[model samples]
Target chain A: MQLKPGGIAATIGALAAGLVALPAAAQQQQQDAPSVAPGNAYDQSASDVDALVADSAVLYYQEDGGRVRAVEAETGLAWTGADGLAVSGRFTYDSLTGATPNGATRARYDQDFIGPLPAGGHLPAADTRTGASGAYTAPAGTLPVDPHFKDQRKAGDLGLTLPARAGFRLSLGGNASWESDYTSWSWRVGLAKDLFDKNTTLSLGYNYEHDESKPITGIPMPLGSMGDPAIGKQRIKRVDSLVLGITQVLTPAWLVQFNWSTGNSRGYHTDPYKLVTLTDRDSGDPFFYVYESRPRRRIRNSLFLASKLALGSYVTDATARWYHDSWGITAWTFGLSEHLPAGRSAYVEPLVRYYHQSKADFFRNYLLLDEPTPTYVSADSRLGAFGAWTFGLKGGVHLSDRVELYGSAQRYVQNGKRFYRDAPGTMAKVDLFAGSRSTSLVAGLRYHLR
Target chain B: MSVDRRLALLALTAGTLALAACAHDGAAPHLKLGARPWERDVLARKSMQLAVEPALLAFDDHTYFSKEAAAGGRGFDGGGCGCN
Candidate 1:
């Protein structure tokens, strides 16, 4: 199905109508169970139907200066079976287009690029060119960008939950995502048990993922050197992670959750499309660019904690996370949100989050020709020391007994750390702190179908 | 303290709290069986959930994962994307 806004609503209405009757009959037959409150059929059915929710959302994301624009549509369906089983599925389609920064600094003259060469062919050297209308200028003192960047991706997920016993739940899931240049498949298993009268829950989970990336154009020459073979090939990366979590009901109005996780990734971790500018060792003048490289293995760990408290008609949530990686990066994240209800069918939530991270050991904006090339180096800004802030607001209204509508907007900004500098006296005086900003908006409709 | 020590301390604290609760009397039935009838409606409100909306939270997490350098500390983890 197209699942456009109108189509999604119509489809949901029909599907919900068909599915609602089965669950009601099942619940009525199961009213003999002690847990089913007598004469509270609506509440019992509501609780049962609440487990099944269908969602459709459209998202728009934009970066500064008309840079990258991404539009995505996502749909999800989750239903609980009568035999202590639940299944859920999700699918998302993303279309991305626009200019993206190419790791080169602003130059005194315009820069031009040529050809998407086939495998084993080198990228044409950057140069200035003349057009019919005279010199074609790309402008100076601004970040270099590849103007013809575009891609599309489709991702799907499936999950199953089974209540194996009185107090234990088991979950299994798999995911597949495919893009023009990349494909990934992952599987996960999780188990959870309730203790202390179901107030304390402990869970463990593990996941494994395998990914293959084949750059649409071709893999650049090794070490980013010129005149090298730009082979068209597929690179692989794999990750395995484990998680342990605990949730406790502290009081009638408060609850807390904690999670500890560890993971490791191996294989190609570099940005295939990014490169580092090489500068003259002594003069600090621009020399050339080379493809970025990164370590083959990465180990990471994180601890996260979250708490929720209810006060009258308002609910508040707070979370903190600490993360560290073998790449010599450490990060801290904190967030808070407050949900306030308006009347009986509407709610508004305001959220704010702050994140700060240390740079990887091999991160560099530009490499000096005088220094020996490291085994691993990258110019990707995400690997550098930076701080990010996100502000968001979301509101939802109940449109009908089975449908709810919600929309959200979020703004994110990342600024480089002030303490970072190239080395005392480099040839170029590049400003590494030029930050990036983006905004995202999402509109969604949810259906509680029995 | 080191991260390992802190983790140990937190685990110990959680163990102690659970044991202490187990030892205590039925002084707070509301914390055990269920909430009082007067507060049931409020407790059952959809907005009271930590995630509130699961699909929306999942989408937000995916966006952050693509843009940020961190991932996975929540209850469950899976899936990989080429957003980077």
Candidate 2:
């Protein structure tokens, strides 16, 4: 072979390298460079190449007053090849059922609505009315609801992560979701680079999403009467998002991340089933209930900061966010989580989060019948001023070397303040607050296939 | 308390946290501290990650997005859910 002389030279070089230790500068460079060990071709242990890592979870959520009930099952699978290439995919299925608010506050008198929803736009066709008549009534002092709310959603995402030139890792992913009334698809690309002795990372990502809505009840013109004929059958919404993030390790036991995200959405943003009621200026009696209206464009921005601290075997994470949008909505969120060890193979985490948001510019509790309807108006409670809190506990235990099981439960409570000016006398005693209380229960198993 | 006093208190609390964060950062951001490279085994633990539970984080994001007026603080991938 031609390597006879080169082989001898390489043998001598190996001996020289073994006889003397590397210089301090060389050692530092070696420390900063990423490891490419024989056993870690995929950046993990050799056994990971032979094992399929999968995570499966099931969650149930229910809101108070039977507002909404949902169950979801999700699974994620990952594979890493010896060539340092990785592929990951996720699948999710969820079924939702129960009554949902139709955006009208409870008043002193009973309210009647048409079809399975409170909107008159959902009226059955003349030919099918005999077999599929749908209507419901809200009792006195009760919030109007759509009792026939039911839907199933299936979603999936696939991603690839691979190393790029100049010490950067690039990621490409796409996601799609389908439901009876709505569908969405998105593609995202991301780039991340490590620096400062591998103690800091900078990342940038961009995503574009397209969504379509085909309401079974038909799409009505903005602010139009409930019984008006549908303006169209389908509407489309699109969003473009960009995110910049930085992760830094202050000490061996502390890590912090800062992220700034911005997005712009155009097209449909209003809920088709929601309605707003108009009351007479003199008697406060309900005069008309019409579909809601919203602007065609929205721009949003947020700043997020999170930190994790390791104290011995215990770990704690704290996060805070500031959010704002062109719709005149501002929000703040804070969260804290602590992971404590219980035994050799088990741990528990207690978490708490707080959120508060101000009312949107066009949010109206109720429109006045005597006055002209504003260009943009909505009674959806989510657009109003509200504060929320979440408390949760999660625990996990290793059933065996290859299996881990975990479960969590969390309670969410929201409180809002509703206000209106120049209301009629009869509306004085009505409860206008719109809020919700819900509970979430989740359980999951992670298995390593060999 | 008055609004001014409350604002002052908030500022003070934030300053205190900032100092604490910098105590190990050596007066500036992203600066290495006393811990040696080999001593970072604890930081390698999964629990030490910013968001340890990915699944739980996703669920929380979805829940808050549906409940609140403003969304999109973390990940940019989210579908338009017909939720109230």
Candidate 3:
């Protein structure tokens, strides 16, 4: 069932009551509380105490059923005339499919560094790092394939501020992903500078990535005669990217941001794990085959814009993005979000996003068996053009001064244009391929300590 | 050339600038150090300090970005298995 606006309101009311009751409980047990410094306790107002408590204890959790799960914890401590520091970290686990035979499982870890701006010290910058790994088994009865596939990825980044005279900050990062026979590595560095006395921020960045894989041997061909295969074949690919952007604060409550990026890729871009089939000219029968090798080059550009508005008691945010690539693909995305207070301490946000993309340059329905072909024919679904829409609802409830509960659910649907194929002469028949529409639900709770 | 000396010099410069700025701004009346009006009641409420921002977004994006093979979310695009 869908959660209507009234239901959201009721949930918020309950959260508000829960938040307000905590102070009452603490007051009832005040006699048991620890002693406070004589003048320090009275020097600060009640609101200062509340702010201190809120800033010290913060936790977050989210779970997407059978797809993803995550938890985060953070704590901050502030002293008079000294910089405030907050330490936070997150962990996530995801299982793409149900406990099916071909399901995949992935896990990730992240840490963030946050600190207050030094006196006139510009905005505080943060650093983050994440590592992930996953393994998946091919679906049953699909093709003669290996039992399973495994991969691991790790990334690290640093965000730092530059001197006001330099008018820029720098962000540097590196990443690596490896499998049994393949490895990918990437590095990126970016700079951002504010102008017009913080009214506008401009950023520029560059990135380079490389991938190398060792070809597998000793596999029996499905259609062709088996032969003693040559092993130790190596494949390599490289990608380079440059991005530029600017953000402007139109007003105290309004902002606009724009970004443009260009990317160039070269080398072996074909997937060795997937293949396509073509019907024979003489027999008119389909034969499954694999691509030997193919090298490709691609260029891509993307732009994104976002704005946020505050209305009386609610905040509204909107974002739009466009992307174009030399592979003959163009795509657009739009998103909207609204956050409303449920009660004194809790709030709920509803979000929706829509995305659409055009087809690739070499995407094909099928290939004729008799036709002389290029070096590659792939059925990788991501290369196809498609459109998808998602609707989601999430609620956040504060259970105590340092604890929170939250849950969210989303429904997604995709047009069956690129992935789903329609056989000739079948008006109502459609083939549901490996990629299809799906739905997810998530919920989790978190607690923090000072 | 020693690391300690370099750090000491850096600290001296930073301290000098900080002290100078504080001296110039110290004469100004202290803005009451407390939560803003909108934050006053919210902070007093329990769960106001709960951490939920990045974790929720990270999980949701991870699931869909990998499963649907869509792009965006938490930077770095394309790396894992192309199963989606």
Candidate 4:
């Protein structure tokens, strides 16, 4: 269900109430549920010994309507030195293929979507990464889908943690990623300290990111005609972020975390390949398509609170988040999960998360020929107000004393709220809120050895 | 940084500092503090980690970036990937 303007506050209130009752719930569960705690071995940190936690997973995501399928594989290893120094590294590879919906909506007449000419291709190049030329024709009354959307990415990360003092720790991290049309390099540093016998922890972190984008068809001017000459070959964007995290153990069986993060992104923020169609006022026929435009700078902030309660052999987790940005968008997210031990060596977890977002300042379904051009405008559905839910189940088994294997399946559904009341021509009659249905599956193994 | 971001960052710093000071002053005391060394056994379970599934969490962050318009509430995410 969509949340009203004041609904975010209500959600926060409910979360606070849940937080207040967690201890009570824990006491009740402990009394009724059989204690399944393993004979007295505590967290790895309790023992001053070198330790390692390594894991690997592969995920497959598919969206219906023959649009946007992805395969992502990741592996990571974290090592904790007996003397309090930690080191970690990770690698990820992602492959995305299949068609994706263009911002343009369906019309009564067939529409031919063309691309920029390639180095050796014919007049219209349909796919940029592949350097292929062909016009994708959207059949009359069908939503436009760009069948040539494809890309692969490789990314790596490294981190280090040092014990600066008796109760303070410092961390440093870096990341690099490469794609056909984009690349990014980022770094971060954080400092944390433990208080109250390590029962409470506070951390502060800062991240800096730099990105370069070279659109497949060459970068174009914002809101410029698709037939216009290319404006440049590449653009740059930079984002600076600050994060504060607080983790407090409310009781022996419960812990709560609060985090506040803010980020500012400046520079080119437009999606060069995405376009908005301007339809004829009467026929609803496509008159022209132009690149969508967005503000160059964005400042964002969020407040997050999460609580985990361990009751006997079961665990319950609840989380809430409120977010806002300079572009006149606000969002709220709530998540709940329960873990039940199935047997001596296995368990299953079910989780549900709901998200709601308000529209951006300049979001529009489509532009009209007669209407004057606004300073900023976009047809990207991602900027529109919408609600989404994710339902998932995960099961895991301990293969041995130090080996575990797990898998999970999840489904995501999104529905755009009807935010606009007027549109020219048949555009007003078309169903513009065609939210996506996607499912993902993950399988992985983890091993622990000292 | 933009002026708004600068102000926000300043506020984050002030908030962090305030919380840290409150904790340093022994505001909670041992009685109200969390698990003791002996009580740590149950709380130490892997399931109790803030992120029970780090891999899944990472995957979701990337997946949702394309579909949603919100980010930054859990932890620091080093930016990577050209999200469609």
Go through the candidates in order and give the C-alpha RMSD of each one to the true structure. 8.0, 15.3, 15.9, 9.3
Give the winner by DockQ: 2 or 4: 4
- Write candidate 4's Cα lDDT for A76-144 as tens digits: 898888888889899998877777777887777888877654444446555556331236888888778
Off by over 4 Å in 4: A1-49, A117-122, A126-134, A418-421, B1-31
User: What TM-score does structure 2 among the candidates reach?
Assistant: 0.82
Q: Evaluate all candidate structures by whole-model CA lDDT and list the values in order.
A: 0.69, 0.73, 0.45, 0.76
Best by TM-score: 4
Which of 2 and 4 is the better model by TM-score? Answer: 4
Which regions of candidate 1 fall more than 4 Å away from where they truly are?
A: A1-46, A50-52, A112-117, A120-138, A417-428, B1-44, B75-79
Model 3 agreement with the true structure over A1-450: per-residue lDDT tens digits: 122456445544554554454445334323343233222121112232212222221122222222222222223232221121222222222212121111110101111112222233344222111111122223322322222222222322222322234555665555555444456677777777765445456678888888785433322122221122223256677878776666655444455566666667787665544444453444433343433233377666666677655454455668787776766777888888776655443456688988877766665444555676655444444555677787876665445445545555566666645222333322113232334355544444555343
lDDT of 1 by residue, A1-450 (tens): 112456545544543443343334343444433332332222122244336889898877778986777777899998987766888999998877766666555454455433234464454432222011111123655566666566778999999999568788999999999877789999999999876655667888999999997865456655656334556567899999988887766666777888888888898787766667777666555677777888988887888999878786677889999988888888999999988664445567899999998888998877887788998888777788889999998776555456666777789999875333454344235565534789887778788775
Itemize residue pairs with steric clashes in candidate 3. Answer: A58-B51, A59-B50, A59-B51, A60-B51, A63-A442, A400-B47
Docking class of 1: acceptable
Better of 2 and 3 by TM-score: 2
Please provide, for model 2 over A143-244, each residue's C-alpha lDDT reduced to its tens digit, 9 standing for 90 to 100: 888766767788998999884568798999988988777888899999998765556677899999899987776687789876677777789899999887
Best by lDDT: 4
lDDT of 2 at A205: 96
DockQ of each: 0.33, 0.25, 0.05, 0.47
- Going through the candidates in order, what is chain B's TM-score? 0.57, 0.50, 0.31, 0.59
Which stretches of model 2 miss by more than 4 angstroms? Answer: A1-51, A115-133, A418-422, B1-36
Between candidates 1 and 3, the lDDT winner: 1
- What local lDDT does model 2 show for residue A364? 81
Q: Return whichever of 1 and 2 wins on DockQ.
A: 1
